[model samples]
Target: MTDPAKHAVLYRMVMPEHVCPWGLKARHLLRSKGFTVDDHWLETREANDAFKAEHGVKTTPQVFIDGVRVGGYEDLRRHLGLKAPDPQAKTYGPVLAVFAVTALMALAVSHAAFGSALTFRALEWFIGLSMMALAMLKLQNLETFSTMFLNYDLLAKRWIPYGKVYPFAELGAGALMVAGVLTWLSAPVALFIGGVGAISVFKAVYLDKRELKCACVGGSGNVPLGFLSLTENLMMIAMAVWMGVMALQHG
Candidate 1:
């Protein structure tokens, strides 16, 4: 095991189900700092409320750094004096080119799949909607993109740390491609990630696995998972890439 100071961090006073982003952020931040963090995200709602009431921190994300209390997002930002990712064109050059290529490739694939349909068929609609759902799930919070690892859902539901490599890289790369909100980064990351998700949906449908939760994000209601999910992921991947690229170029 690595030295604690070299690679050990701990998060205490956590609430499991009530929120996911705060602890998530702490973990990601530690990873950025080259530390391995142990997260404690379990607290009773009543207990959580009592603590919050006492501290005058009415929400989740009350953080403690090295056992010293750090404030919530605003406080953390103030403390760190963090600079947001440069939205300026100078910093995101490669990202712009990648997204442009991705957008074109996606269009080609989409046309091939649908044969220039002005009105999409039911299968097409389902696929489109599913993509939106998955994309939105992560997009709902910017914190998701900042994760330092991936979960190998087919193998283990636990997060596979980014350090393990490959599939994790794919997951992170794919997530950024699909889920990033920044214009330059979001599109390519979305394209790659959404494309992967599309493929997964199709493969699952091909294998006839229908009972599982689709795990698609927003606007997915009782939708049959399978072809619809695949189509949706693929389509959004393209759009996200375009938006990201556009955002970068004009900056």
Candidate 2:
């Protein structure tokens, strides 16, 4: 008696010009799941076309378990009780990745420029890098970002143009802060926007009790619009005030 679970047949495209990645993935998946794969490589375009036509399927990398057809790579994943990866799935991973990388870069740059890593300047660099990274995400798709921003932003709700300019303003302030130059421009912009953002987030989440996504990362982000949003605004405010005080004292 042959066990159906132990055997799989994979029909994948493999040619001189190109090899299908999904086909390779299918083979790997089958092997990982303890299936002995009978891999069939269609060596040419004509062979691939003939196989698809004979099987009455549109695409290659088709799988079969115990002589029962299991369709393509996605179908195989379903058969194995694995959810296909969704690119549009809302997650904080993108924002978290950006912040983590930017923080490391900031620390590295700070260490290189200054003799120590633990300085007020390092904090400024972290904040600046974080802001620039966030702005870059927003600027990727301004239309989508603005729509998300207007959902909870007080100023954006009142003035539609504010959403469009927000990313540019953030980028400018962050750049100036990173350079340790143009405190006059950076401080005021950061102060005003950060204050507004903090109040808006507080009102929306704490007062109104509205549960929403944060646009701090991007339009399609899944980061919650509460503590993280508040923290970002507060950080901006602190940076602005610190820079302002330093500027006054240095004069």
Candidate 3:
């Protein structure tokens, strides 16, 4: 049986090029909460603008309950006793997700190669894969990454080209290390960047007490510049040293 009393009027953008995601979310939320939604689409920019002006609101995807304005998506959420996501909240979700995926990949590779998931090779692969994945993220938008990198990276601040070259170097080093070849080159590359990055992170976050976004996960600007960033660099440094020793022993 449908709840006749629970009715919501939703004004949302539905254009040729773009549809309002929030509006979709609002409708879904309304339906999930046992409300019948009367969806109204502002199909054109002019209509959207006119609706905004008529309603004296800045954004679309407005909702009304029982002929009274419930406001936009966030307001509807609040009206429905739900919490809305804060955009400015600092979260390690991206880094944690990256690490989790890389770790799984490492275990998978180790199992495929050594017939055992729990092996020393898994650790090596985890770090190498993490580096490569992070590098790929930065390479997706080099300019954006570099601009964010300059914020806390001491070397990047001084030498702008280093920021641009960093992703390529990381990718090369990670690929070589993962392949277990050219350790002579990969080890040094990893060590140099890791050393510089560790120092920069330590100075900026701890010494200067600066709260900044880490470029480790590229320029999306979610991960905080702190311990995790330092830990990432330290892992590279340790891996570099370990590989360097192994290379020397074999030679």
Best model per TM-score: 3
The TM-score of predicted model 3 comes to 0.92
Instruction: Put down candidate 2 lDDT per residue, 1-251, tens digits, no spaces.
Output: 33456999999998888999999999999888888889999999999999999999999989999889999998999999999876655566766787788788888887898977777788889888888888999999999999999999999999999999999999999899999999999999989889999999999999999988899987877787878778778978999999999999997
Q: Point out the higher-scoring one by lDDT: 1 or 2.
A: 2
Native-referenced Cα lDDT, model 3: 0.93
Candidate 2 is scored at a TM of 0.79
Worst 10 residues of 1 by lDDT: 148-157
Candidate 3 per-residue lDDT, tens place, 103-204, comes to: 999999899999999999899999999999999999989999999999988898999999999999999999999999999899999999999999999999
- Point out the worst 10-residue segment of candidate 3 by lDDT: 1-10
71-124: candidate 1 lDDT, tens digit per residue: 664455564667434333232233233344445544555567677533223222
**In the order shown, what is each candidate's alpha-carbon RMSD?**
19.6, 4.0, 1.9
Error of 1 at 58 (Å): 2.0
TM-score of each: 0.31, 0.79, 0.92
Better of 1 and 3 by TM-score: 3
What is candidate 3's CA lDDT for residue 85?
85
Q: Which parts of model 2 have CA positions greater than 4 angstroms off?
A: 1-5, 12-21, 40-61, 68-89
